[model samples]
Target: METTSSVADIQMVTFLLGSEEYGVDVMDVREIVDITDVTKVANAPSHVEGVIDLRGSIVPIVSLKKRFGLPEAAAGDYNCIAVMDFAGALTGFVIDEVTDVIRVARRDILPPLELGSEPWMEGILSLGPRLIVVMNLKHLA
Candidate 1:
Protein backbone atom coordinates (compact mmCIF):
# COMPACT_ATOMS: atom_id res chain seq x y z
CA MET A 1 0.00 0.00 0.00
CA GLU A 2 1.33 3.42 -0.97
CA THR A 3 0.44 6.00 1.60
CA THR A 4 0.59 9.52 0.24
CA SER A 5 0.12 12.58 2.46
CA SER A 6 -1.51 15.64 0.99
CA VAL A 7 0.82 18.58 0.59
CA ALA A 8 -0.17 21.62 2.62
CA ASP A 9 -0.78 24.64 0.42
CA ILE A 10 -2.18 27.99 1.49
CA GLN A 11 -5.86 27.76 0.77
CA MET A 12 -8.15 30.53 2.01
CA VAL A 13 -11.78 31.61 1.95
CA THR A 14 -11.70 35.27 1.14
CA PHE A 15 -14.30 37.76 2.29
CA LEU A 16 -14.93 41.47 2.50
CA LEU A 17 -15.43 43.48 5.66
CA GLY A 18 -16.13 47.08 4.81
CA SER A 19 -13.68 48.01 2.06
CA GLU A 20 -10.89 45.67 3.10
CA GLU A 21 -10.45 42.08 2.03
CA TYR A 22 -9.68 39.34 4.54
CA GLY A 23 -9.15 35.61 4.46
CA VAL A 24 -9.12 32.57 6.70
CA ASP A 25 -7.76 29.10 6.12
CA VAL A 26 -10.16 26.86 4.21
CA MET A 27 -9.58 24.09 6.78
CA ASP A 28 -11.01 26.27 9.53
CA VAL A 29 -14.16 27.22 7.64
CA ARG A 30 -17.08 24.79 7.79
CA GLU A 31 -19.64 26.60 5.66
CA ILE A 32 -21.10 29.97 4.76
CA VAL A 33 -24.73 30.77 5.48
CA ASP A 34 -26.93 33.74 4.81
CA ILE A 35 -27.40 36.27 7.59
CA THR A 36 -30.08 34.96 9.88
CA ASP A 37 -31.76 35.93 13.11
CA VAL A 38 -29.38 35.88 16.08
CA THR A 39 -30.56 35.37 19.65
CA LYS A 40 -28.85 37.90 21.82
CA VAL A 41 -26.82 36.64 24.78
CA ALA A 42 -26.86 38.61 28.00
CA ASN A 43 -23.50 39.82 29.31
CA ALA A 44 -21.69 38.53 26.27
CA PRO A 45 -18.61 40.26 24.87
CA SER A 46 -19.12 43.30 22.64
CA HIS A 47 -17.70 41.56 19.62
CA VAL A 48 -20.10 38.64 20.00
CA GLU A 49 -23.23 39.34 17.92
CA GLY A 50 -25.21 36.44 19.42
CA VAL A 51 -25.94 32.75 19.02
CA ILE A 52 -27.77 30.98 16.24
CA ASP A 53 -29.28 27.51 16.25
CA LEU A 54 -27.63 25.95 13.26
CA ARG A 55 -29.21 22.58 12.53
CA GLY A 56 -29.74 21.99 16.30
CA SER A 57 -26.18 22.97 17.21
CA ILE A 58 -25.95 26.35 18.91
CA VAL A 59 -23.27 28.37 17.23
CA PRO A 60 -22.01 31.64 18.63
CA ILE A 61 -21.73 34.48 16.13
CA VAL A 62 -19.18 37.29 16.22
CA SER A 63 -19.06 40.52 14.30
CA LEU A 64 -15.72 40.77 12.56
CA LYS A 65 -16.37 44.47 11.98
CA LYS A 66 -16.64 45.05 15.71
CA ARG A 67 -13.67 42.76 16.33
CA PHE A 68 -11.59 44.85 13.96
CA GLY A 69 -12.81 48.16 15.43
CA LEU A 70 -14.78 49.01 12.30
CA PRO A 71 -18.04 50.87 12.36
CA GLU A 72 -21.08 48.62 12.57
CA ALA A 73 -23.42 48.43 9.63
CA ALA A 74 -26.96 47.18 9.51
CA ALA A 75 -27.21 43.62 8.18
CA GLY A 76 -27.73 43.94 4.45
CA ASP A 77 -28.58 41.43 1.75
CA TYR A 78 -24.91 40.67 1.09
CA ASN A 79 -24.05 39.86 4.70
CA CYS A 80 -23.17 36.24 5.50
CA ILE A 81 -22.08 34.06 8.38
CA ALA A 82 -18.86 32.20 7.91
CA VAL A 83 -19.05 29.18 10.19
CA MET A 84 -15.63 28.14 11.40
CA ASP A 85 -14.18 25.61 13.83
CA PHE A 86 -12.04 27.35 16.34
CA ALA A 87 -10.31 25.12 18.89
CA GLY A 88 -12.99 22.46 18.53
CA ALA A 89 -15.82 24.95 19.04
CA LEU A 90 -17.91 26.06 16.09
CA THR A 91 -18.21 29.83 15.76
CA GLY A 92 -19.73 32.03 13.10
CA PHE A 93 -18.28 35.25 11.79
CA VAL A 94 -20.55 37.86 10.29
CA ILE A 95 -18.97 39.36 7.25
CA ASP A 96 -20.00 41.68 4.45
CA GLU A 97 -19.48 39.23 1.58
CA VAL A 98 -17.60 36.09 0.66
CA THR A 99 -15.46 36.62 -2.42
CA ASP A 100 -13.66 33.45 -3.47
CA VAL A 101 -11.52 30.50 -2.53
CA ILE A 102 -7.95 31.30 -3.41
CA ARG A 103 -5.00 28.91 -3.58
CA VAL A 104 -1.55 30.38 -3.13
CA ALA A 105 1.79 28.86 -2.33
CA ARG A 106 2.97 29.04 1.27
CA ARG A 107 6.02 30.94 0.14
CA ASP A 108 3.81 33.67 -1.30
CA ILE A 109 2.40 34.67 2.06
CA LEU A 110 4.36 37.57 3.53
CA PRO A 111 4.77 38.20 7.23
CA PRO A 112 2.72 41.11 8.53
CA LEU A 113 4.43 44.39 9.27
CA GLU A 114 5.63 45.04 12.84
CA LEU A 115 3.63 48.14 13.51
CA GLY A 116 0.86 48.10 16.08
CA SER A 117 0.51 44.41 16.80
CA GLU A 118 -2.57 42.75 15.33
CA PRO A 119 -2.86 39.31 16.89
CA TRP A 120 -5.58 38.11 14.55
CA MET A 121 -3.68 38.85 11.34
CA GLU A 122 -1.63 35.80 10.32
CA GLY A 123 -0.02 37.24 7.21
CA ILE A 124 -0.51 39.35 4.10
CA LEU A 125 -0.93 38.07 0.54
CA SER A 126 -0.45 40.21 -2.53
CA LEU A 127 -2.97 39.24 -5.18
CA GLY A 128 -2.36 41.51 -8.14
CA PRO A 129 -3.62 44.99 -7.20
CA ARG A 130 -5.35 43.78 -4.06
CA LEU A 131 -3.89 42.58 -0.80
CA ILE A 132 -5.60 40.01 1.34
CA VAL A 133 -5.04 39.85 5.08
CA VAL A 134 -4.97 36.25 6.22
CA MET A 135 -6.43 35.93 9.68
CA ASN A 136 -5.84 33.51 12.52
CA LEU A 137 -9.27 32.30 13.66
CA LYS A 138 -7.96 30.99 17.00
CA HIS A 139 -7.28 34.57 18.03
CA LEU A 140 -10.89 35.52 17.30
CA ALA A 141 -12.19 32.92 19.70
Candidate 2:
Protein backbone atom coordinates (compact mmCIF):
# COMPACT_ATOMS: atom_id res chain seq x y z
CA MET A 1 0.00 0.00 0.00
CA GLU A 2 1.23 3.46 -0.83
CA THR A 3 0.51 6.46 1.37
CA THR A 4 0.47 10.13 0.34
CA SER A 5 1.78 12.81 2.60
CA SER A 6 -0.65 15.47 3.75
CA VAL A 7 -0.20 18.92 2.25
CA ALA A 8 0.22 22.05 4.31
CA ASP A 9 -3.11 23.82 4.38
CA ILE A 10 -5.00 26.40 6.40
CA GLN A 11 -8.46 25.76 7.80
CA MET A 12 -10.82 28.70 7.75
CA VAL A 13 -14.32 29.35 9.01
CA THR A 14 -16.28 31.40 6.52
CA PHE A 15 -19.23 33.57 7.42
CA LEU A 16 -21.42 36.19 5.86
CA LEU A 17 -21.56 39.90 6.55
CA GLY A 18 -24.02 41.71 4.36
CA SER A 19 -23.46 40.32 0.87
CA GLU A 20 -19.76 39.67 1.40
CA GLU A 21 -18.07 36.49 2.48
CA TYR A 22 -15.32 36.67 5.11
CA GLY A 23 -13.18 34.11 6.85
CA VAL A 24 -11.05 33.76 9.92
CA ASP A 25 -8.53 31.19 11.14
CA VAL A 26 -10.48 28.20 12.41
CA MET A 27 -8.11 27.84 15.33
CA ASP A 28 -9.26 31.19 16.65
CA VAL A 29 -12.91 30.20 16.60
CA ARG A 30 -14.31 28.86 19.85
CA GLU A 31 -17.93 28.16 18.96
CA ILE A 32 -21.03 29.37 17.14
CA VAL A 33 -24.33 30.17 18.74
CA ASP A 34 -27.69 31.49 17.72
CA ILE A 35 -28.48 35.15 18.29
CA THR A 36 -29.76 35.75 21.80
CA ASP A 37 -30.72 38.66 23.92
CA VAL A 38 -27.72 40.88 24.51
CA THR A 39 -27.66 43.22 27.45
CA LYS A 40 -26.78 46.67 26.26
CA VAL A 41 -23.71 48.30 27.73
CA ALA A 42 -23.35 51.95 28.54
CA ASN A 43 -20.91 54.12 26.61
CA ALA A 44 -19.78 51.28 24.43
CA PRO A 45 -18.32 51.48 20.94
CA SER A 46 -20.64 51.78 17.97
CA HIS A 47 -19.88 48.31 16.78
CA VAL A 48 -20.52 46.72 20.14
CA GLU A 49 -23.91 45.02 20.20
CA GLY A 50 -23.66 44.32 23.92
CA VAL A 51 -22.69 41.52 26.30
CA ILE A 52 -24.07 38.03 26.73
CA ASP A 53 -23.81 35.35 29.38
CA LEU A 54 -21.99 32.39 27.99
CA ARG A 55 -22.09 29.57 30.53
CA GLY A 56 -21.87 32.14 33.34
CA SER A 57 -19.08 34.11 31.69
CA ILE A 58 -19.95 37.44 30.17
CA VAL A 59 -18.75 37.94 26.60
CA PRO A 60 -18.94 41.08 24.54
CA ILE A 61 -20.45 40.86 21.08
CA VAL A 62 -19.55 43.03 18.12
CA SER A 63 -21.69 43.63 15.07
CA LEU A 64 -19.71 42.84 11.94
CA LYS A 65 -22.02 44.99 9.82
CA LYS A 66 -21.45 48.01 12.01
CA ARG A 67 -17.74 47.29 12.27
CA PHE A 68 -17.45 47.19 8.49
CA GLY A 69 -19.72 50.21 8.02
CA LEU A 70 -22.29 48.15 6.19
CA PRO A 71 -26.02 48.63 6.36
CA GLU A 72 -27.70 47.24 9.47
CA ALA A 73 -29.27 43.84 9.22
CA ALA A 74 -33.02 43.76 8.95
CA ALA A 75 -34.92 43.08 12.16
CA GLY A 76 -35.91 39.46 12.76
CA ASP A 77 -33.27 38.23 10.37
CA TYR A 78 -31.69 34.93 11.26
CA ASN A 79 -28.19 35.51 12.54
CA CYS A 80 -25.58 33.86 14.70
CA ILE A 81 -22.58 34.73 16.83
CA ALA A 82 -19.15 33.38 16.05
CA VAL A 83 -17.17 33.24 19.25
CA MET A 84 -13.45 33.66 18.75
CA ASP A 85 -10.38 34.36 20.83
CA PHE A 86 -9.20 37.86 20.10
CA ALA A 87 -6.13 39.21 21.90
CA GLY A 88 -6.46 36.41 24.47
CA ALA A 89 -10.02 37.45 25.25
CA LEU A 90 -13.20 35.68 24.22
CA THR A 91 -15.37 37.79 21.95
CA GLY A 92 -18.24 37.15 19.62
CA PHE A 93 -18.94 38.61 16.22
CA VAL A 94 -22.52 38.84 15.12
CA ILE A 95 -22.69 37.70 11.54
CA ASP A 96 -25.37 37.26 8.92
CA GLU A 97 -24.72 33.54 8.51
CA VAL A 98 -22.17 30.84 9.16
CA THR A 99 -21.28 29.34 5.83
CA ASP A 100 -18.78 26.49 5.90
CA VAL A 101 -15.42 25.40 7.17
CA ILE A 102 -13.05 24.98 4.27
CA ARG A 103 -9.44 23.95 3.92
CA VAL A 104 -7.32 25.78 1.39
CA ALA A 105 -3.68 25.37 0.48
CA ARG A 106 -1.38 28.04 1.86
CA ARG A 107 -0.42 29.08 -1.66
CA ASP A 108 -4.01 29.95 -2.46
CA ILE A 109 -4.11 32.88 -0.10
CA LEU A 110 -3.11 36.19 -1.67
CA PRO A 111 -2.10 39.50 -0.12
CA PRO A 112 -4.72 42.21 0.13
CA LEU A 113 -4.76 44.90 -2.52
CA GLU A 114 -4.61 48.68 -1.90
CA LEU A 115 -8.24 49.33 -2.82
CA GLY A 116 -8.83 51.57 0.16
CA SER A 117 -7.34 50.70 3.54
CA GLU A 118 -8.93 47.90 5.52
CA PRO A 119 -6.94 47.30 8.68
CA TRP A 120 -8.78 44.10 9.57
CA MET A 121 -8.34 42.40 6.22
CA GLU A 122 -5.37 40.04 6.31
CA GLY A 123 -5.57 38.39 2.93
CA ILE A 124 -7.81 37.20 0.13
CA LEU A 125 -8.66 33.71 -1.07
CA SER A 126 -10.20 32.59 -4.30
CA LEU A 127 -12.15 29.34 -4.13
CA GLY A 128 -13.64 28.71 -7.53
CA PRO A 129 -16.35 31.30 -8.01
CA ARG A 130 -16.18 32.51 -4.41
CA LEU A 131 -13.78 35.14 -3.16
CA ILE A 132 -13.34 35.17 0.58
CA VAL A 133 -11.79 37.98 2.54
CA VAL A 134 -9.64 36.68 5.38
CA MET A 135 -9.86 38.77 8.48
CA ASN A 136 -7.28 39.33 11.21
CA LEU A 137 -9.05 39.19 14.57
CA LYS A 138 -6.11 40.82 16.30
CA HIS A 139 -6.69 44.02 14.39
CA LEU A 140 -10.39 43.86 15.11
CA ALA A 141 -9.83 43.49 18.82
Q: Candidate 1: where is the Cα deviation over 4 Å?
A: 1-8, 75-78
Looking at model 2, which ten-residue stretch has the lowest summed lDDT? 1-10
- Predicted candidate 1 versus true structure: per-residue lDDT over 39-139, tens digit per residue: 99999999998999999999999888888898788656447899999878999989899889988877788998999659888889999998999898777
Give per-candidate clash totals: 0, 0
lDDT of 2: 0.89
The TM-scores of all predictions, comma-separated, are: 0.90, 0.91
Report the C-alpha displacement of residue 46, candidate 2, in angstroms: 0.7
Error of 1 at 30 (Å): 0.4
Against the reference, the lDDT scores of all candidates come to 0.87, 0.89
Candidate 2 per-residue C-alpha lDDT over 29-85 given as tens digits, one digit per residue, 9 for 90 to 100: 999999999999999999998999999989999988888888997876848999999
